[model samples]
Target chain A: MAEIIGGYFTSHVPAIGGAIQRGDQQTPYWKPFFDGFPRVHEWLAKTQPDVAVVFSNDHGLNFFLDKMPTFAVGAAAEYQNEDEGWGLPLYKPFKGHPELSWHVIEQLVADEFDPVTCQEMLVDHAISIPMELAYPSVAEWPVRLVPIGINTVQHPLPSAKRCLALGRSVHKALASWPGAERVVVIGTGGLSHQLDGERAGFMNPEYDRFCLDHLASDPDALTRQSIHEMVRLAGTQGVEVLNWIAARGALGPAAREIHRNYHLPISNTAAATVLLEPACGVWALRRRSPRP
Target chain B: MPTPPRPGARPEPIPGTTLFDGDAARKGYHLNAMCYSFNRKENREAFLADEEAYCRRFHLTAEQRRAVAKRDVLGMIAAGGNIYYLAKLAGIFGLNVQDVGAMQTGRTVEAFRQFLLDQAKGA
Candidate 1:
């Protein structure tokens, strides 16, 4: 059986990313956010995982309206985080585990997920931002990366269920990898937000709390809602929550909530992080009815 | 606006990486937002009239110019042209790259542009 080394959830907000890149992590405003993850930091210091499955949506960097791919996987040798200048010092590019990554890819294809495969892929701030948060120990991070790029911004965004299904499939793929050990799967995105137009700074703490509650109990249930409702209640950009579904689905029905944190920083958004640990077996998932 | 490359300019692969060459892919998420935004028939007239001016405004590089000139969709990406620019080229060539990414995970230039604008501000 595949041993899920727990899962992590976070956001790729550029402001937070900028703060880290500029080396201003010590700033008072950013302190609470960092402190909230003491358990997460401690876990990383202890496990020092060998691989991180980063699920991030791409910026317009590679996928635009003309040729956006919904689910593209990066099987590159190295992936770099762009320091969009807000002072996050540029870090060395993260190396990838192509062998294991490809194995998982082959398995997914066999399982019927038509994943977009790429050898040369450019990851924008969206992916990089989350990496900085989850693995600050870049110089010595034990994790090799497997990048899963999603298209969250363009039209025809994946349904929440689609994102969740992708996550579950990832688990199926990982279970069959040969000799690959010590892996962490991360789902990153939003609690609530609207980063565009006159409604740019919208926030919904109520919805954020409600969404987290639903995800912990039954992510599959949460995945059934439409993006329109999310935008109306949570804000247009709040649709980012769809990305989190991918993470939640991978945790499976038996996933136990380890740590959860949600906060509204800079007024326009609510950022949250959740951790899930898988235990027991597929038998539980097969026999279980989703809890609400 | 710069004239279209005269015939026979020997279209080269866009100067950077594709989804295949992970070793040297995009240097940064840095992109020209105007490219994708202006890549529509409605906006094509304005785009052509002020192409060079617009490229300069966005601080686009020479490589990007060649990518757009050749109408090399993949090259536009490999050569460092931003989605904003590539989208515009796609508009001209009648292709839609943003839809491609969307089919998988659902995305749009507006979301990307917003993210970058946020970075440009916070950075």
Candidate 2:
């Protein structure tokens, strides 16, 4: 059976990608945000998971209002990043894991999550930034990408409970796959920052920190939160916290927090990074040397 | 089949705001698509070179085109503009999302900044 190794959660702020493009990672404004990823790099180098199931919301890249899929999974062999109309540099193609992606999609539907499966999807900064931060590769992405886009753009989005249920379904699917592959699931975007309305430039370090703390030990509380509650307290766009809830659900209740980092006011958003390892005995090998 | 909402049901509107739901998305389709085009540098240049022609090419409504021409952030929002895409239109005027937010709230940029500061401090 396939093994679910662990999960990671991080912010997908485009400006962090901009910082890397400008070689501004060392600058004072960016140093803290950039510093959060080295341990992620170290972990990736050590585990070298075969596939990464990335959970991120689109910002009008692939699905516009024409036919938005509240939950969509990408099953393409490659995903190209497009310019988000703000001059953010597009990176190289992210190699995809179509077979695994299709399997997960089939299982998710069977498990009643009902995601729209896309054969072609042009991912934006929400998909690219976290990959760049964790892998920082110009050649090819370190792991095969499985892009799962959840709707944070439109309202009446999947509730936190629904997001968590989707993640749990994904976890179940990964555990049952008839393969020896290792996988790491990632949820990207948000730690309480809004980009529109009078509340623009909103950053709630307290809310963000509270989220991180609970994500480590009590994700259910966060999962119980409604989109309105999240927006009311965390700001409108801060509703992207649903991504983190999904990732937490995949990690399961017994996962241990491997590492976490939070930084405020990074490009009009509060940025964060969290790594969790499943406590299942199947993952014991991850702590030892890499298998040949 | 899914359970239907009770007859005559309507969601309570978030005060002083447009929700940008599927209905709003349908209304703003052409408008947001036009704004999405501004992601490319040449597209931004084209729109800047001839705003009317650009809106025409994108088939924006009179309301959307007017909103674009006048740089009315709130009006744009009311016309179904998603804030993310609207940021591109705002960018053409050297305005950040915060600046657009100020316009939406009918507050000066300085006041908007102070409002954000107060919110952050309180949390």
Candidate 3:
């Protein structure tokens, strides 16, 4: 059976892509944000996951209002990134694992989640920026990917509870698959920041901190709020935390926070990165004990 | 203007936030579709070559056309533009999020950047 290794939750702000492209990670403005990733890199180097299941939202790249799926999964053998109209450099294509993707899709349907399955998908910065932050300067990503997109663009989005349930379904699918690959689940986007209307610059760091504190230990607590309530508290765009909540659902009930970094005002968004491992896992245990 | 609330049915406003609901979606479809076309380089170029022609191609409403002409972010939103799609339109003029944020909030770009930095102090 496939081993579920851990999970990562991070903000996928598009400006991070431009900053990385310009090699501005060390600039004072970007340093605090970029500084959050070294620990993530260290963990990735140590664990070396063979496959990653990413839960992210499409910001008008693949799906527009014409046809938006509440939840979609990529079953392609490869995924490509393209221009998002902001002149960010395009990233190299990410390799995909179709077999696991099909298996998960099959399991999700069996579990009644009913996600749209895409064989050809164009990923935008939401997935690419986080991949860059995770594996900086890589020609090819180290792990095969399964890009699961949730609808954040269109209204009447999947509720926080529904997204969490969707993640739980994904967790069950991965656990039942008979593959040997080590898998890492990722949820990308948000801590809080809005980018529309009069509240374009809204940032609720207190609420963000409350979410980070509870996501690993009490994910269900985070899910109790309705979508409207979430939007009110987290901001319109800040509700991308749905991705984080879904990703946390994949970790099951025994996950522990191994690492976390939160910073503010990364391109009109609150930025965050959190790493989790099974509570009984070696890394989680190591985190609790004093360094040698 | 927003429709008046029904008697005893007032929903609290989010204060400067507009939820891109079905009403907004229907109202801004052509405008958003026009902006969405900006994702492609050629479409962006075509729009740049003849802005009025491009707006006509999408059949944008008079209000939407005026909003785009004036680079009025708030007016665009009032005309039912979603920020995600509006961003592509903003990019054509080299306007980043901060620039748009400032425009919508009636602040200078530097002031908007400073406002964002001030968030850190609150955090």
Tell me the deviation in Å of residue A267 in model 3. 1.3
lDDT of each: 0.62, 0.80, 0.89
Q: What digit string (tens of lDDT, one per residue) describes model 3 on residues B20-106?
A: 877788999989999888889999999999999999999999999999999999998888898999999999999999999999888
Ordered list by lDDT, greatest first: 3, 2, 1
lDDT per residue as tens, model 2, A6-114:
7888988776776888899999878888888899999988888888888889987777677878899999999998877776567778889898888889889898778
Q: What is the alpha-carbon interface RMSD for each candidate?
A: 16.7, 3.2, 2.3
Q: For residues A1-292, what per-residue lDDT tens digits would candidate 1 score against the true structure?
A: 4346778888776567657657767677576566656778787677666788878776555565446677888898887654232223555577888876787678768767788997877666666667678777557446788888777665456778888888788877776565647778887777676543234344667777777887766787776666545556666557777777876666565677778876655324567777777755686555344547
DockQ of each: 0.04, 0.42, 0.57
- Indicate the docking level reached by candidate 1: incorrect
In candidate 1 the C-alpha lDDT for residue A3 amounts to 48
Candidate 2 Cα misplacement greater than 4 A, ranges? A280-292, B1-17, B39-42, B98-123
User: Given the true complex, what DockQ would model 1 score?
Assistant: 0.04
**Model 3 per-residue lDDT tens digits across residues A96-159:** 9999999989988998888999999998888888888999988789999999999987788888
Worst 10 residues of 3 chain A by lDDT: A281-290
Local error of candidate 3 at B63, Å?
Answer: 1.3
First chain TM-score in every candidate? 0.88, 0.93, 0.94
- What TM-score does candidate 2 get on C-alpha atoms? 0.88
lDDT of 2 by residue, B34-123 (tens): 988887899999998988898999999989988888888777877888998898787787887657767877788888767655654454
